[model samples]
Target: MYAPRSPPPSPTSRQLAIIRFGLARIVPIDDEAPFAEIAAAAGLGEVHVRRLIRHAISQHVFQEPRPGVATHSAAPRLIAEDADLAAWVRWRADDCWIAAYHACEAVARWPGSEEPNETGFAVANPTSLTMFDFLATQPERASRFAAGMRLYAAHSDLDLQYLVKAWSWGELPKGATVVDVGGSHGEAAIALARAYPSLSFVPADVGGRIRYMIHDFFTEQPVHGADVYLYRACFHDWSHRYAVRMLQALIPALKAGARVILNDVVVPGPEEMSPGLAAGVRTGDLGMMILFNAGDSEMAEWARLFEAASSGFHFKGGKGHRAQGCGFWRQSGRDIVHS
Candidate 1:
């Protein structure tokens, strides 16, 4: 006799909406409300609410204790308590869901474009504008995206403290200047300043809280010959083509012996990632693919990127942090070794 086999179940938009609806209304209460009440609050039909509730229960998002009464469970309660988690869920349901829905059509149409505007997000919204530009036009979605990033850092343990502890910042000479390229609001610089009082920082970002001149990374870096040019969670947003441009922009400003440190994901090779970390890393890779046609780089890919970016950049090595990854390198006197 052959062993039994069942088809794998795929996720549906209805399932996402069900969870989103549950998150919006279902709270811990004395009495469980019937499906009709939930439907009224959610602006959904009674029969539709009943089916959604049943699906949600199967997914462990909500619970149905009695025949018709729906109540809060552990998962829904957590979403209710954590504002960031709730915002993340909302972003997933509203933004990412739509983007993913339109991804197939985008791929078929654009084929292999690396521009951010060529992404599924653009196709879904029927705009040629990039994500940032589009988000700028829609304040609410932009706010949600910002909140989602902050919350994601909490979820992934990729906070300022991790950067402070992961590197050897104290070893740098006193008064050494560290430029945070593409560092929004200078949070990393602020954290480093606290950890290493002997050093100074320059933040190259718009609307920064610090007292530095605003500069774009795509343009020539204004602060030349800094001790270090730090890129935290920035390079991964671009494809190798644009990433090389960003590095080239910084090359003229890099003095001899200047270090280039990256605080981003170093994607693991096949069968290399631990089971616990595989999901997060792969999801991140997929997210970049959908949004910008970019991706996290593996160790070899990182080295190759530096080589391709400039003949002067040398690939030192890389390692993992709590959840984030690190790549270390410096401007070499000799020509860069091609992979």
Candidate 2:
């Protein structure tokens, strides 16, 4: 009979620091190199490099077959393959980890503050600037953050094809206009345009997109009467108060038959999900709390948000309602009221 093994202990801060140093320095030059050679490449002493490598070996990040040789394992190999993945690791080690360190003090001082600027990130940086503003001043850090987001999108199930396959976009009339709000880089719009040639897309990011309307959801929307308004993974970054305002901004522009589609996680109740699934969402919730005092909403909260936005709005059918959840809300027309 086979015996079950216990899970490995979490890596120590020193271990993580060593991992970051090695990832930034050693991995790029050679996946497998002598300890002395790696030390020379990284401008560190051989003894210290061996110690860090041994600790990393314990975590399966790298391998040491003999006393003097170091080689990349699956984890380090994967990181070496993608520059963005490496940037993500560095960002986590540098930025996110620093913010997390100050989270307790931030919570104690703020005492339920809803402002994003009052976050742990803000507390750690010793600036009145929001994390976004702070990152703007640090271009390299900002570049890493952007690269990390791209890595996240590339690895996660949140790919554009997932949205295209899940939603019934073909149901709409040919030449129907779809407005992608806050559509950074127009990734989703471009993907959808390629898949459904019949549909017209206006991505509200970057210049020179045909008839691109600069609509900020915080204020009133500029593009009115579009067949569909698409908001993908946008709402979870804000508190309910801001989320309500964002939704309300759409009300003025939304014509009778207009559909507002939100592609975001609809967090399930604790009892409704497996422990692993629950942990995944709750982990995201904690990150949101630390970063922006925001959270993933449950289905009831989503329904309430729409109702609070306006009585004329109603929740409608949606595919891909479970994994990487999406929801559809329709604006009620006078003649064909949906209540």
Candidate 3:
């Protein structure tokens, strides 16, 4: 005989704005302030702050401590850890993205130069500042950015470890090499090497970042035959024209039948086609678009690039292959093999 509870209302645009404002202030969820204190800090009226917090909590961005107090929740925590999320939010709030939003107004007034790059503020407002560039200009932002990446890496590492463990490594030769392309700080390499003691790993990145790996190489080289190579993420941040150049750079060093791993997202189909999977893929794709205007490849795209490489190497069937929606190919001398 008890009355049924009503469903919470969906979030409104105004509520979303307030939530974003709150997120910029409160990071590292473990440290949170009282509602009144946060409201005053944000310069919003107490009633308005309360209403905004209430709405945010319902949307799972903020968690209410009691009736009036709230703290950051999983959604914001996930967002904080994501570099792309940070970049997207910054872009959306930035003058550049804001101007892009109003680009239609200018187009309506003058019909010429309709291309996004020509009219959109993202291109016109050339800050020449990448997220890393911003970090260089604003040291504090860099610290926050590093902290966010660490959080993301920690979470991602866990998932990667699980995948590594779940997949059968029988396909690999007894002493085969596993090269981790764009490996950051050697964490992924260390994890995989530790899990599969028999396998050798080479952690590759840019020259500056590789210095730390050089020290590790000298100390642990004999033990694991570990080597570090330097290549820039800058190439990956560009179009296929530059991405092909980046891939070509690896040709001289690659060994036949060696596993070359590209640890990046494989974009999914349209959102309407597969809601949950598409959401995850597009989330990553958008992040790439916002942060560097970089294009992350789909499986087919990866295969094409692999075929075009000097070695003409293709990715063979590997762990999480089907789930990732990626294709496989192989290389023999200059001939490319696709599956």
Candidate 4:
């Protein structure tokens, strides 16, 4: 009888590290390279490089064509061709991997902190600054985060087309300005500007109807009386209390008829989706907790958050209830939360 195949090993931090190490060392090569040459490129000894590569091979990340050479296998080859894929893996492996291990410790230390500075990421990295501030100081890493997040947004139902149609942009009066709060790289702003042509950041490429400026979300909203202030996939990065502050910060700018829209994840109900999709949302919630001590919330939790932030806000119902997970909320006489 044929021998039974062994099941693949469960993934661990070391396995992820091996995948990253192998990719960092191997994907840049045009073809298979000698182990020593690869090691030289990475400034590591050949024996160490070979050992890591061998482990990565078992994970189907890289390949050893002969006894001494390394090349990209199916997984690593895909990673080589796709910048988004590379960024996704690179960010998770380089940033999140360390933070995940300290999550329990962070929970024990901070319990229920609303401060971003008390996150597992803060514990693992030992920095005084919060994750976003730290990323701002690291240009290269920030760029990677932005790129990886583009891929993430696409996957997480944060598409530009989906967002555009979520609300009735056409109903708004012409020359209406929509502030894309926390709009990293301004992809959504750019998308909206194109569709409306009467609307208007990161590269200063936006002008006329759109303008680019650096403003902290924690600060009071700068562009007051705008028709809409949209926060896309932004609030989940903050703790419940911090998220409240984010909403509170916008209060001074909100006109009576102005809208604050949220395009983010609404923690899926147990019966609302299949187990697989539900698990995905739950995993995301866990990720938020690990990195920022924040998370996705249920509908009532969202309503309560609004109530806690300010009594001015109330659920105007999800205008985009069918937009997959990109449900949009419209709150009258105050702010909106769209998930």
Candidate 5:
């Protein structure tokens, strides 16, 4: 006789409301703006925010005291502490992404451009510089952007901890030097150094960002000594050609036998084939596409890109080299030997 299967757990109303409040950060929500006030601020009827808050309350994403007031609770705590979410919010809510969202409509009208046809938005409203470019002009927004990124970093730290702990680094050769190519503030590098005291980590990024990391984390003096490098999610922002060029820059510093560790999503197989996994992969791909006009890549694609960079350079498998559930590779001749 087969045993009965357990039913899926149901979310509490309070939990759902809290989640809605977090999402509200993406939309517009303010303590000064109650449900009706928020609706007015959004230029909608007062009942709209009320209806939304009621539905969210059912989901437990926010807490509603009495009839229409909504406030923060435990549900939004995760989002509050998340760095990527903060970055996304700052990007999306900024005038640039908002303008781009409006501009997306123009794609159908005009089609030709020397650059990639995918504009952040396609509709014709007002042509302006990029959000980051605009932020450069407005230093205050840039500061806000930095603050948002820090919030996102808090959440990312947990995930980084998991990845670092799961991937063994003790096997790396003594005096192994790591370069975090685009590490924002050396958080990942610090974690790795703490875990493996012998390895040295160097967190690298563009000038301004790197300066911030030096000020914030390295204030107590350099922690990783000189072995490991924590790049975080920098190289993935560029095309494979540029990524290889970035790697080439590090060859002089990279000790022979030192490994490059990339912490990013590896796109999975087709959608109909692996529904759940495909959904996640596709979502990540779309995120990269929308945000940076980039997409998630397959392991084979990564291997090919790495092999193309140098003649003898290939994936050396040991610890911290496994590609999650995917296969591994080694460079041999012009071919990438996968196992």
Candidate 6:
């Protein structure tokens, strides 16, 4: 790949502006629509649409074949065609954008705070509740957020298949169980069962058995002595103090030799990856800080978290994987720390 040219002193803002403006909804994918026609369809004045589309062209969102006509480029075309993708863009442009803008103000208001309620998101949105709590009350925004996350997960390193293969689930004996702690919709658990029928899932070979129960991670773990207690993409949402509580809750239920698998992002060291990849990861890391007062951690932090929760947690260490990138921290609950 060729080197990226230095960006102009001021980059274009009209791409995200148009997306926020709902230009995607009115722009035709195949039609090389004229300026006035596009404006009329979008119910906007001709000058505004023309300016937005012209600026969007520079951002590689759309292109103008002639002075007065415009059509979709690859970027906007894909967004227009995919509803989930569009929602993701909108969510980014709206909620995330607001939070990012108010990040400094949030820090100023609640200096060095770890409370989820004391976040940029809370500041920008005027909520006493945290992001998840506030989202629950607003159904439309909640649906958009859910759809955005679905698209984000499917496209990002947090794909479900990665969690399935991050550990050797097949090594466990037949009829061995896996308790997916806070496994939303049991998607990771279901994928694991499908891969290794030895555990429970919809394989039909193991009687297609999968019991999904709602158990709070902050409370005690209900399923005791399972072969694997998996927390995929779960811990990063919480700060260290609370995350420790979640791990501690498992102490009573954890039996000797039971494995605790953490399938989550590990913060990369500087110069460890390409600029683009690192930027995305760093964006997520800071986004966690802004939204939840949480973070993607380093391996040392993971080890420390386990150690903090209980001295009995044997930190088997963690490694980066192609499937999950910097993910999967494995520890064995060889000794229980019962309070």
lDDT of 2 by residue, 238-313 (tens): 9888888998887888888788777776776778777667777777788888888788887777777787778988
Q: Count of backbone clashes for each model?
A: 0, 0, 2, 4, 38, 0
Candidate 4 local lDDT, 265-284, one digit each (tens):
66656787676666766777
On the 0 to 100 scale, the lDDT of residue 184 in model 5 is: 58
Candidate 4 Cα lDDT to native: 0.72
Lowest lDDT 10-mer window, candidate 6?
A: 328-337
Clashing pairs in 6: none
Cα lDDT, model 1, residue 244: 90
Scored by lDDT, model 3 comes in at: 0.49
As for candidate 2, its clashing pairs are: none
Strongest candidate by TM-score: 6
Residue 174 lDDT in model 1?
80
- All candidates: TM-score: 0.85, 0.83, 0.56, 0.80, 0.57, 0.86
**What is the per-residue lDDT of model 5 for residues 211-240, given as tens digits with 9 covering 90 to 100?**
223322212223333344444555445556
Instruction: Give the worst 10-residue stretch by lDDT in candidate 5.
Output: 328-337
Whose lDDT is greatest here?
6
lDDT of 2: 0.73
Better of 4 and 5 by lDDT: 4
Give lDDT: candidate 6, residue 305. Answer: 91
Q: Rank by TM-score, highest first.
A: 6, 1, 2, 4, 5, 3
Give the runs in model 6 whose Cα sits over 4 Å from its true position: 1-13, 159-161, 201-206, 274-277, 323-339
Give me the overall lDDT of model 5. Answer: 0.49
Give residue 292's error in model 5 in angstroms.
1.4
